[model samples]
Target: MKTELRVAAYAVCVRDGEILLARWVDREGRKRWTLPGGGMDHGEEPVATVVREVEEETGYVTEPTVLLGIDSIRRNWLRRLAGPGDWQGLRILYEARIVGGTLRNETGGSTDLAAWHPLDSVTSLDRVELVDIGVQLWRDRPPLGRSRLTDPANG
Candidate 1:
């Protein structure tokens, strides 16, 4: 089987009582809430990737204030268009602050909508596991730069 690796950056932006989120549209057209970030471009630093991705997905110019954690996952992509393979994802999480721009949905992107949701109600939304991981990392601030909670979906 082929082996593929993907490195991405995500931001956990919390203000007052809300957390910024983007709606990710998957291959099946199912929409799920996710952190405001995406994959890093070639030769781009993870910090730049997070900054750019937040702006692209949420219409907010952000500055990463702290490196929260890194979440890694591996899965078997049996139906991958590029052929069956083992895929590993390295997700870098950061605590970011919005510096400028207004709240607006992205156009012609992987994510279609962006909004702030009450932190208390985040678990009720249909969201990716990364959302939980990001929040946990932010809230706990584990010294190892990793979340204490394991992703059940990945296991």
Candidate 2:
């Protein structure tokens, strides 16, 4: 079987010891905080995709300063939000600096609100494992390139 691959870009925005995050409400009305970004569009550059996603999701104009690292995650189809289907995604993480724009909620977007949380208190919030990875990349940037085996399925 041919494995399907998806390419996504995400941004880690930090300022004043706080990290910017988007709160997404699931179908059950439970909220989860995640980085500001989304899947890359055809012919879109990774950096460009991150910039656009951040602005669209959080209303902040950001510039990706550096490519933090790439995460290759594999998960069962049923365990994913997309329902049962095997998935392997290559996520490009970026360290970004907010340059302009005011913060606003993205109406009709996947996220319900955007806010900054204390870096140390991020663990207290309900977040995905990818959030932890982004924080680590921001706190202690690894040697770059690709970082694999991130998802539990591959472990």
* Root-mean-square deviation of every model: 2.4, 3.5
Q: Candidate 2's residue-wise lDDT over 1-155, tens digit each?
A: 33578899999998999999998777888889999898899999999999999999999999999988888888765544555676798889999999999999889988899999999999999987778889887777778544433645446
In candidate 2, residue 71 scores what lDDT?
83
The local lDDT score (0 to 100) that residue 128 gets in candidate 2 is 74
Residue 94 alpha-carbon offset, candidate 2, angstroms:
0.6
TM-scores for every predicted model: 0.94, 0.86
Question: Could you tell me the C-alpha RMSD of candidate 1 in Å?
Answer: 2.4
Once superposed on the true structure, which residue ranges of model 1 sit more than 4 Å away at CA? 80-82, 151-155
Per-residue C-alpha lDDT of model 1 across residues 1-155, encoded as one tens digit per residue: 89989999999999999999999999899999999999989999999999999999998999999999999999997864777899999999999999999999999999999999999999999999999999999999989887877745435
